[model samples]
Target: MMREILYRLKDRYHFGTPTFQRDDLCFVTVKRDELRAILTELRDVEGFTHLTLLTAVDWLEERLFQLTYLINNREANLTLGLRVMLEREDEPGATTGDTIHDLWPTAATYQRELNEMFGINFPGSPRVDEEFILEGWTDLPPYRRDFDSLAYSQQTYNDLPGRKTHDPRDHMKKALYPTYLKEAE
Candidate 1:
């Protein structure tokens, strides 16, 4: 079922082959400019009515952020992942894409979360500029792969007075194999 749809989209709009695929799932990587159009076609023509997931992954090494939209067809028992890549760095307008909230209202929340976490802009989403999970956050988006969790945690949280940090391996070796530690020393 997905194969036919992929072929049709490829013929019509020159969509590429699946980046990764399995028996019940297929992932197609599309250009940022083509995302909304392909998704609209999938929902309107392919009977993939359910937008199961919409999220972004930071590829810090590649300097790219990959946005994935997962859609499902219940009757066919199939799931399709539409992926698009965007620049990680903030350009003149920042890395933004069209809002699909109109197609799937729930996408508003997902877009908001992505905006809050990854700093990916969605120009038309009502809540995209608004805060989602994090309120009054002044730092970089917490979910970005480049976010320093240790630094943020240290800055945001106070250390408990009695808590002692220890190397887990050293503590485990001392406790579970005292004789081995003694012999090694």
Candidate 2:
């Protein structure tokens, strides 16, 4: 069923090959310019009524940001994830994406969050510039692969009073298999 749909749209949109992750789920990469049109057709004609999510992945080495728009056809129990890649810029606020809030109002929230977290601008998205999670965040967007989380914690937070850090592997092993460690020793 999903393959048939992709075959029909493939000729028209020239999107990348459909990658079927499951019987009900498929992902296809679409050009940034064609995303809005493809999404419109999916919603209006293909019976994909729900916008499940809109999320971004920062590909630091590739210098790209992949935006995935997951749409669902509740009646058919099918999900289609459309991926669009945008060039990642060195300067913050340089990478931009089209706002799909007009298609799905919930998309505005996702776009705002992406703008705040990944430094991906979604122009014309409602409150895209406003802080969605981080307030007064002056450093690099926290979600970007380049962001140094440990460095940020070290710089921004002081050590808690009488707090001791433990190695995660040892802590997890001790918590889950206390007797196993004693037996191994």
- TM-scores of the candidates are 0.85, 0.95
Candidate 1 positional error at 32, Å:
1.9
Write one digit per residue (lDDT tens) for candidate 2, span 1-185.
Answer: 88888887887896887889999999999999989999999999989989999999999999999999999999999999999999999777899999999999999999999998999998899999998789889999989999999999999999999999999998999999999999999
> Stretches of candidate 1 above 4 Å error?
19-21, 90-93, 168-185
Residue by residue across 98-180, what tens digits does model 1's lDDT show?
78999999999998888888888889898678767888988888778878999989989999999999999989988999998
- Candidate-wise lDDT, in order: 0.84, 0.93
Structure candidate 1, residue pairs in collision: none
Cα shift from native, residue 60, model 2 (Å): 0.7
User: lDDT of candidate 2 vs native?
Assistant: 0.93
